[model samples]
Target chain A: MDLTFTERENAFRAECRAWLERHVPKESLGSGDTREGFARHLEWERELFDAGWAAVSWPKEYGGREASLFEWLIFEEEYYRAGAPNRVTQNGIFLLAPTLFEFGTEEQKARILRPMARGDVTWGQGWSEPNAGSDLASLRSTARRVEGGWLLSGQKTWCTRGAFCDMAYGLFRTDPAQKRHHGLTYFMFPLHGEGVTVRGVDRLDGDEGFAELFLDELFVPDRDVIGEVNQGWYVAMATTSSERGLTLRSPGRFMATASRLVDLYGRYRASAEPALRDAVIDAWIDAEAYRWYTFQTVTHMVDGQDVGASSSLNKVFWSEMDVRTHETALALIGDRLELDIDHDAPESAGDAVDEGAWMRGFEFALAGPIYAGTNEIQRNIIAERVLGLPRK
Target chain B: MRFAFTEDQLLLRDTVRGLLARECPPDVVRSAWEARSGRAPSVWAKLAEAGVTAMTLSEASGGLGMDELDLALVLEEAGYAGLPDPLVETVAVGAPLLEAVGTAAQKERWLDAAAAGDALIAVGFEGQPFVPHAAVAAVALLHRGGDLYAVPREELPLEPQVSVDRSRPIARVDYAPDARHRVDAGDRAALDAAVGVAFDRAAWATSCVLLGLTRRMLDLAVQYAKDREQFGKPIGAQQAIKHHLATALIRQELARPLVYRAAWSLAHRDSVRDHGAHVSMAKVHAANAARHVAKTALQVHGAIGYTIEHDLHLFQKRAWALAAMYGDVGFHRARVGAATLPD
Candidate 1:
């Protein structure tokens, strides 16, 4: 029931706040939502790491503070409250770091962990091929055995941040004879390796966050293999599990956004139509729900309960909330929303913040039900696993 | 800050769940539902004996010094069991209001008795569309002109009517000029604070009850879908049944954390203004979810569910009543939108 930080934890929060205040450039605020702007976000993450605060959940030996999960939660609250960054390195910090800590060898950890934690290297996911998105087990990516390494060849579409990353961790078909989830291997391949071409995909907003990767015999040494060969499905599942189930979304950051939106509505209240007001309220409620939901997750973590299928619910809830909120904002702005105004709320009687963010947000919201498994997928998980219903 | 419950709370949940399994089984709940008064005094007395009535009250007030989250678990379990009682009114609103805003004399006179399950307290907000189960309440608290009051049911205009859920009675109670208890306190600032806390607790607990009922409805539907068959195949094997149940499951799951988190926040008094939004979200999701689950369950059960002899309508009726109880999804969703996205 209690959501307050302990005295020591409050102190930790203060420390985090102080560090963010010093390192996060003032220009960084409200600067994300675009590829180049996101690059600046990566730079801020580097500063956070240099200040000894980035990825606090990682082991200290791997350039982390090795803090408890509760402390990590606190770090997230304070980090977002300070408006630090939008977490451009989320793939590395949230998904890969945990995998490396648990299953990778010490050498693998030593080689991959530090630079990634330091934000010096950005990594993209090479899991989804053109034909293997929903049925990921049907991936045809190949990694053939060789004297010094393995040769990988496949095309990975929908590679978020693929165009900006220097390296990628992939699940390739290491065993060509087998099919359907088995015979796969996890490999870490350099984005700049021979015969690799990454072409950015322009989103509706005219910005590129995803890319299509063409791999022509990319070489991945044996040392780069993660976990056992042909066991990448399980390893990949572990990554997906932690990403969906374990990690806590930054509640305070969204609250700040809500607060700002409130301010925005007030400034334009005279011009806001009644229907827009209604839309605004709908968006606000979704945001509030997210904060409370995260608090519940924090409670479960405090109680040492694994969130399990409950976490699946959150993935759907928060993502949809984000879309709804932005949509409301866009509607309130009217025709003015069509222009690009990223700095501050524009006074031009248009959507000063650009309708594109809202349009982009709506498109992205559709992905919520799609990614990390669709909402339908999560529903089945709940009915079968949590409710003990028959799968049929 | 940890948003999770302490180990003690987890253990408390386990204890309450186990107790309900034994005493509040489906048959027991069915009988309680069929009763004319909507609830049995003896059954309520047993709940009080189990300390369910006083779990969230201070020890000084002859009860446990548990927080709202702990009480939420109790409310949730009661809802899950479909126990016909005003547990939220008595516990969430009455006890906590007495603790936070009640004078020493008021606590001694009302809260202590309420904690002991002697003085059952309920609230009638905006009076007219009275909440089901308010007629039999010992005391009905209300909010008028930002002032909290405790008015006698006899003094107010109360018209008792049969509710959809026969287990809970509803009365359209109107306020009389001379019937209100003037809760004289400090200035406007302090009064709003006190009323706000009570509202948050009440709203959150209501949402929890709805969540419990919604989860139960989904469970019943899923179970029926598995057992009920048509044309030599289980109904659940059909895509229509699966999709219907799937949607219900979606709404139920979405409602859970919203209700739980709202309870958690109120118990801790974190972000006071946002409590209403959380409560609204929880209610919106739960109300809609419960109704869908109940309807789908009944539909899946065919003619069996429509009979007065069957228990399926009991849950369905409660869901229908609750959907309007805390403001419908549209009301709350709009409330949430305004509160969080005010600009």
Candidate 2:
């Protein structure tokens, strides 16, 4: 399909790119390094919010630009091209903001969405319990009905950014008497609230971006409930759909990153193995394909086609592609990859930006195919639902 | 802004679907497959009478004046029927190219004859002698020195090549330089646009045909799973069969929109940054999807599916053949890489 932007869209993109070049701090951008590097990355999000450039897809009422889906893509492209850090509040802004817009009450929107748009608050996901990673229906986290509110008690593992966030929105088993998927309810609980304990997961490089949380009778008001009680699975599914469905990255963004990787690879060419070059090319193709695929989806969405399954395919491709690109960078840096590169690292030292970002990328990419449903699951959806195969 | 087909396009799709249902049924395709000519001209006449031939040309040229994507819908249905007619060559390639580059005299004479079902046209390129459905055609478009010349079919030498696909007879056509009827336009640009449109349409039509075949493969797998017994239950109940079929469906689903998107973009002349990239992706994706589904269908059917007496191999052969058409997966993937890179 035709993938180029319109002149008007192009002009808008130029404006956004100009703004990004000025407002984004180069030091705070990710070299795909340590948890501290990610933390520094948040400063860029703060800058974007201050400049009114973040979360343009959110409704205007929540301090967003209320852009069309296509414009939103233009915004992301510019943001990525700027080489800004990944959003610390992506779960809140990309996933929860849309969820709140659709299913959240007006009051809830007023309370939670503005701070998120303003970069004043960060949110973490609390979906997977220790036993319920892929078979999400098997969650054991419990929340009992109380006189004033609900009392939550259970442990949530793999809680990304859980130890460092202001609040959490999770699916809790509000009715344990009901089995497998029926009894769960969605709740918005403050991570700093009483009776909640968070233990960060220590990585090989000592990054604690991921956490495990124990919710010991944490009280949450009925007002914090996202949608109808026990209907959270559907709501969660919808949220995941929006999370995966929208334009996640812009072509400009990938172009910038690919250029950076290419530069880094050139810098290390003497030490860099030939295999690394192949990986760079692979990353380049994936990034480009994903970019075109995204533009096509935006066109389809703008044209009013129901754009669900197609977006899933894009998510699967890009998420995996992101991992591959980052991993290639790590390989080029070799032993210097493990050093904790951060804002404090010397500007001239490549290791300052290496910090095993690629290894983490590999891990994250590995998880990507697993999270948002495995690639196998996506394939099944494509086959049965999209292709209309006879159900065996 | 609209991605869904316009009302008239929908009606055209329905009309073509109905016409194919009667004239190009499975039996007709089978009969043609069994015969020497590999095509039923009467069926082509019926399609021509239905105006499938003229739907892409301008009304002033005695045709419907539809865009390239509208004609794609007609071609897709024809592919589904395994219709051996040169509808793709005549309407999809020759007619559109003539409309773009033909002189007033040429369009007046040839366009009317083509629309009136009195002539058929085929494209002759230098490197590839094998033009799909080239035999039994009335007109040949020979490309040389970047210009397209209209050569009478009688003047060309065609060597019949045994093809894997029997539904369409292909021939390697050789042309002499002096026999060409040179046109006055910018031949290079015309040839470029024509080839692009032809590849886009062929890639998409082949994909939709694969879709139809894949859909049939999935059905066959599911039906066999339902009927066959294993471990005291229907094999359909087994996760192995169920999941295999499921994955095939996923690939098909993933590719369907892409095929339509490619066809739609070409039809409306949408953005070109993606120009060949999307179609390549669609073709590669569809080809792999169809191949996987067909292979899995045979595996699920176990013994009977492998027999030549069965229809499974027909889909398998078509998938293999279509995958090779319009450039194979490797070629199209490289095209995607080139299309997607920073300008």
Candidate 1 DockQ category?
Answer: acceptable
Docking quality band of candidate 2, CAPRI definitions: incorrect
Q: Ten residues in a row with the worst lDDT in model 2 chain B?
A: B334-343
Given candidate 2, what's the lDDT at residue A80?
68
Candidate 1, residue A162: how far the Cα is off, in Å: 2.0
Clashes of each: 16, 8
Interface RMSD values for all candidates: 3.2, 5.2
Tell me, by DockQ, which candidate is best. 1
Which DockQ values do the candidates obtain, in the order shown? 0.45, 0.21
Candidate 1 lDDT over residue span A1-392, tens digit each: 45566888878888888877787675433434456666777777777787677788777777788777767867876776675667778888888877777789989998988899777998878878889887788888899898899988989987767778888887998888888788999888888857899988876555577888999888888999999999998888778766665463555655665555576677677988877776666555556566656666766666777776776666666656666666666666667766564434323344433355455445665566676666666666665666565666
lDDT (Cα, tens digit) per residue for candidate 1, span B37-76:
7665665777778787887788877888777777777777
How far does residue A138 in candidate 1 sit from its true spot (Å)? Answer: 1.0
The Cα error of candidate 2 at residue A186, in Å, is 1.2
